[model samples]
Each structure stands twice: as structure tokens, then as C-alpha cells.
Target: MTSISIRSNIQTEIREFLKLAIPLASAQVAQATTGFVDAVMMGWLGQEVLAAGGLATMIFMAMMMTGIGIISGVSPLVAEAYGAKQNRRVGQITRQGLWIALLLAIPGMMIIANLDGLMHQFGQAENIVTLADTYLNVMAWGLFPAIAFAVLRGCIVSLSEARPVMFIVVTATGFNIIGNYVLAFGKLGFPEMGIAGLAVASICAHWIMFLSLLGYMVWHKALRQYSLFKTLHRLEPKTMQQLLWVGGPIGITTLLEYGLFTTLTFFMGALGTPVLAAHQIVLQTLTVIYMVPLAMSYAATVRVGQWFGQRDWQQVRQAAFVSIGLAVMFLIVAAIALFTHSRQIIGLYLNLNDPANANVLNIGVSLMTVAAFGQVLDGVQRTANGVLQGLQDTRIPMLLGTFSYWGVGLTTSYFLGFHTDLAGTGIWLGSYIGIATAAIAFIWRFRGILSKKESRHPINGLTFKE
Candidate 1:
């Protein structure tokens, strides 16, 4: 343990963590940039469009994350298999992951098809509801492709070959932008569809990204040896159960967190259009910065899983610590930047000079400060969860997430935003409270697990179980 904690060993682990995380982060950033582009374009269509598009996107993402989160079960499973040199198990897990993605799509598409009713129930305006519904209908076509891509991505990251994933997403980002432009303006002989065009562009991006990665995984000489295409038609029941058992909780956990954010839209919608728009812009900024830590969390899952699979408890703990530390440090800098550039950052989403945009811009700038502070805690919790997932201990964290994000966090936001002077800021503050609690609980859980495992297994005689 002392040797593993020394400066050189720690530095090596840090390097390994970054090696996996940076490209993964870049891929995440590219995907997020697609949404940022959507937000920027929505801004071009005016405040109503921005607000409506933001609302629609929030709903779409909540659905997408729910499915993808379940499919993400492949990540840690593949990592453990790869670590233990179980090539056949890796292939089986990856294939079953794809199956889970396909199955989840049925429900996801149904949810998309019914969003109008949901939006109406939330009491959204007629025009806003109409616009959001139209956007979601087109975006629904991308659901399976998007979820399938998640499975492919999980497999690749666990293989410790993430550069190709970044490549695919960066390419998709370009395609999305160009497609949005051509279809939105009726360029390249396409009929102008405006908002629907953006939705179409996004669908194209998802399908292309998924297909391209699938082709790479199948055809690439190095990767193809595993025969990922070997069992395409057969469904293994046990494999499916493994994926669902692990992934269902992950999916629900993701939904709990994402749904919390989604619920805030209703609160802002109740407050008025300006508040909603402001919240959306602030959300965009938060999403962009979040990719780094999100990537770190993913990297942590892989690195920690590898060590755990090898039964190297010391390295497992070291990997977990370094990943969390790096994410926190990076986000601290991001927080400082967010605080300093609040006005400038808000300007990217709305025109600060335009008197018409003043209210939304001011609200956004204020929320940016809160998001900046919250970002650090968010980094901690997310990366900590990654560590737990790597160790294949997800169910308890799921329970904790339910309590933290909903029981404590959501309850706090409801009171602060509706019953106090905080309003939008209160909502943001409340979400962070939930995030902070998750971070603390998750870290504590990690330490306790390590201590318990150490007592029972000792340093030299250790075996990890999922």
C-alpha cells in the first residue's frame, strides 16, 4: 500500500487514468457540443424557440439517458472480463448489451410518441407544447441508434481503446451541424423544416455514429478477433438478465438525477418564458463543462474494474482515488472560470447588448455562478459512482441516489424555489445539495467497502465479486 501510494506510482496511475479519460472526455464533449450547437441554433430562432427547444431536449435526454444508462451495464462487465482475460465473456457481455439497447427502444419510442400528453399534463403553453411535441416526434427515430451507440461505446472504453469513439463522435458532430444547416434552410435542395430539421439532423448523427462505430468494431483487424459479430441473432437469457440486473438500477439512478433536472423545467415554465429560457441556457453551459468529469467517471469505472478484476485491491483503491482527485481539481478550475466569465458565458446563448435579452441574460449569469460551485460536488459524486460501478456494487448506490436526489434534493428545491425568494437560483441550489449529498455518501461507501474487504480478504488473498 505504501509503495502504491508513493509519488511515482501515484503519477503512473494518474497518467493511466488520463489516458483513458481524455479521449473519452473528448468524445463526450463532441456529443455535448452537438446539443450546444442545437441550443445556439435555437437561440437564432428567437427566445420562444430557445425555450421550446430546450424543453423538448430536456425530455428527449431524460428518455435517452434512461435507456443508455441500462445499456451502460456492458462497460464495467466488459472491463472486468477484459481484466481477467476472459475474451469470450467480454464478447457475450457486449452482445447482450446491444440486445438490451434494442429492447429498451420499444419503451423509449412509446414514451416519445406520448410526450404531448405528458407536456399537456405539466400545463405547458399550447404553442410550447406543440413545438416540443413536433421536435420529439422526429427525434424519436434516433432512440435505438442512440442507445445502441451507448453499448458500442461502453465496449470500446472497457477495451481501453477510446480514441476511435472520440473520432466517431467528432465526425458525427460535424455531420449534425451541416445537416442542421442544410435541412433547416432548405439548402442542398432539401425542403426547409426549421425545428424539425434540427431533429432530423440529430437522428442522422445518431444513426451514423452508431453504424460507423459498429463497422469499426466489426471490421477493424485488431478488434474483430474477439468476434463481436458472432452471436448477432441469438438472445442469451442469462446474459440479458445480467445486463438488466446491473443496468436497470443504473438506468433508474440516471433517471432519478436527470428527472430531477427535468422537473425543474416545469418549475421554470410556471415562473414564465424568460425564466425557462434562462434556465435552459444555464443548463447548456453546465452540460458542456460536465463532460470532463463525466468522462473521468467512465474512466474510473474501467480502471477500477481492471484492477478489481486482477484482484489488485491496492491499485483499485489508488485508481479510484486518483480519478476522483483529478476530476475535482479540473472542475475547481472550471468553477473559477464559470464564476469569472458568467456574463461572457451567458452572452454566448443570449445577446447581452440587446435590451430585450436583459432579463434572461441576467438570470442565466446568476445561475452560472451556482452551477459553477455545484460542478465540483457533481464531479465528486459522479466519479465516486463510477468507482462503485467498477467494483460492481450498484444496487446500494442506486438506493442512495434515490434518497439523495429525490428525497432530500428534490424536496429542498421545491421549497426553496416555490416557497422562498430564491426562485430559479433556489432550484439550482437545491440540485447541488442533492449532488453534494451523493458525493459524500458515495465516498463514504467506497471507504467502508475497502475497509471491510481488507479485513476479510487481506492484501495477498483477495477476490472481487460482482
Candidate 2:
């Protein structure tokens, strides 16, 4: 191609790239907005309520990540199928994921609902246990909808219909905020239910989002082929096995990653209420800022899977490199914004003027500065990991996460926080190290996978068979 022609094609490719990526980014932004609203509304309730809400969220997120990980497995498969023009298989995998989601949610909801009572058996203080329990029970109501939404979301993202998901998520998050205001604080005529109200608002928002996605799927023509409402053949053992094989490790992998953070939060709770509240403030900020790279990762997964389907390895390399470049650029800018606004952002989460929360506000501000760079590495590694998932190289990633989170992240945190004096901030530092290690390992593995001189067996898409 001529230079001008090449530039024109590059521009076209970039636009095409953003077309899918923007919606995915919006969808992630909406997800983060839910937590922002939660924190904002809870801010009106003082540090205790905010701390309680934060604890509840950590517990809920850990459970949600484990359950939702099952659906992530479907994305690469669906993306590859779409790229290969295997429309029927996409529908089939979606069906299987739906069933799996239903099955997974039942147990997940029950486990989280009763987690508090179980925690107290270790002889914890009555107050913290009671608060955590109340939050868990109320949040449990949303579990089914959340899991179902995750499966539907995976199917849609694979089809590159990311825009509609953004619409639903934004709309739902808006309603969630409104509900938090009216119910959590007794705005207008509604009775204030405190933490329970927060829970109710989140639950209602989950259902609304799920129904909205369902409605969109029924009407969208581009998605007609992958509709979940259609009368398809009965469950196939092989299909379920295929999905389970891919999805099982993903679910386990997520549980390992999220579980480590959840454990860290639990340890933070032991430090003091102020520390726990500070951790929550930092976690919410990380989730929001991290979404950009997360969206970039999803885009990478789709593009890579599509290229893999086409057997066009060259395009696959281009897509991976391009996506990583975009993610790095975006996160660097985000890190700068985060560092500059660290104090102001912490102020928003805590009432800086309040006399009772002087300690909480100071600790949160300090942690934000420490957390800023951590999120950048988080973005880098996660997007790189997503690229590997797209290439269907998951086993090693799973091993890395397991070893890094538990062996490196958690172990280092314990030594630094307890053995030394870094405290909760040290825990986050360990997380940075853990993810950085995974990033190096994942990038190396991706290079190795692409550089193999011969075709490998198709089972794991690697040179080795399971």
C-alpha cells in the first residue's frame, strides 16, 4: 500500500477499533459509577455507614467475581465463533452459559448470605459481624440477576454489541443512585433503612439491568442469531463440557484473584474502622479508574479471538499491540489525574470538614497517592492478561494468578503489614507486585505462544494437550 493509502487504512482501523471499544468503555464506566454512587450516598451516613457499606461491597465483589468468571470463558469462544462465522455455535455457547449461570447463582447467593454468621464463629466482635451480616443478606437479593446479567453480557460483548450494554448499565446506575438517596437517607417520603436501603437499591438496579438487556436482545437484529429466547435443541453434554472446561478455570482464577483482595479487606477490618473505611475509598477509586484498561482488555480479547478464528495471525499481533498501546496511553493519563486529584477525591468520599472523621480522611488521602500507580500497573497487566485469554492460553495465567495472589501478594502483605509497619497500604503494595509479576509472565507466554514453529493440538490451543 502507498503511504497515503496506509495512513487511510490506519485511520479506518482506529475508528473501527473505537467503535467497539467506546461502548465497552462506557459499559465499564457505568459499572464503576454504581460504586461511586454507593459511596456518595453513604457519605451522608457518616464514616460508619460508609465503612459498613464498603465491607459489604468487598464481600459481594469477591463472590460476584468468582461466579461471573464462569461467563468470561464464553467471550473468547463466542468471539472466535463470530470471527469464524460459526453463528450457531455462538448461540449454543450462550445457551450453555445461561444454564451455568443459573446453577452458579443459587449456591453463590446462599454462601454469601450466611457468610457473616460463619465469620463470627471465629469470635469476632458483635458489632462488625452484625453490620457485615445485614449488608450481606440484603445484597444477596441481587446475586441472581447479577450472575445472569454477566452471562448475557459476555455473549453480547463477543458479538461486539457493547453499546447496548452501556445503555443498560448507565440507566441502571442512575436509578441505583436515586434509590440510594431516597431510601438510604429517607429523602422525600421514603423511610431511611440505612445499609438495608443501600442493599435494596442495588438489588432493584440489578433486576432492571437484566430485564433491559433481555429486552434489547429480543429486538436487536444484529443479535438475532444469538437470541437466548429462541427454542434451541435440548442441552448437549459435549457443549456443556466444552464451556465448563474453558469456564471452570476462569471461575477458579477469578476467585483466587478476588478472594485475595477480599482477604486483604478482611484483614484491614481488623486494623480499625478508620482503616477499613480508607481501604474502601481506595478500592472504589481503583475500580472506577481501572475500568478503562478493563474495557481495553475486552476489546483486545474480541479482536484477538476474531483474528484467531480467521487464522490471520498477523492481524492478531497488530490488534494485541494496538490495544495494549491504547491501554498504556490511557492509563498513564489516568494515573496523572489520580495523583493530582488524590486529596480532592478522598475529600469527596469523606466529609473532610467533619470533626469525627479527621483520621479517616487523612488516611484515605495518603492511600490514594500510594494507590495511583498501583492502578496503572493493574491496567497494564490486566489488559495483557486479556490478550492471552483471547489467544486461548489460560492455564498458565490461572497458575500465575494463584501463585502470585496467594504466594506473592498475600504473603508479602502479611510480612509488610504485620511483620513491619506499612499497615493496610502495605497490602496494596503487595497487590501491585503480584499483578506486575503476572504481567511479565503473561506477556512472555503470549510471545511464546505466537512464536511456536509448528501447529499445536487444538485442545487447549497450546502445544500441549490437557
Candidate 2 residue lDDT tens string, 1-466: 5989867756665666677788888988887888887887676777677777787788898888788877677888888898888888888888787778788888888998888765565343567677768888988878878988887888888887788888899898889988988888888999988878888999999999988997888788877865555654467678778777777777888888888888887778777888888889888888887888888888888888877777666567668777888888888888788889877888777767778878887778778877887777777778887888787777778898788778888888877777778887887888778878777777887878876612443333332332
In model 1, the runs with Cα more than 4 Å from the true position are 1-5, 460-466
In candidate 1 the C-alpha lDDT for residue 214 amounts to 95
Q: Which residue pairs show collisions in model 1? A: none
In order, the Cα lDDT scores of the candidates are 0.89, 0.80
Where does candidate 2 have its weakest 10-residue lDDT segment?
A: 457-466
Residue 314 Cα positional deviation in candidate 1, in Å, after optimal superposition? 0.8
How far residue 124's Cα lies from its native spot in candidate 2, in Å, is 5.5
How does candidate 1 score on lDDT?
0.89
All candidates: TM-score: 0.97, 0.93
Q: For candidate 1, what is the TM-score?
A: 0.97
Report the lDDT tens digits of candidate 1 across residue range 1-466: 3765687889999988889999999999989998998998888888988898999999999999999888778889889889988888888988888888888898889888788887878878888898898899999999999999999999988999999999999999999989988887689899988889999999999999999999999888888757787978899999889888878888999999899999988888888899999999989878988999999999999998888778787788999999999998999999999999899877887778899999998788788889988989999999999999998888889999999999989999989999999999998899889989999999999999877776777665355452
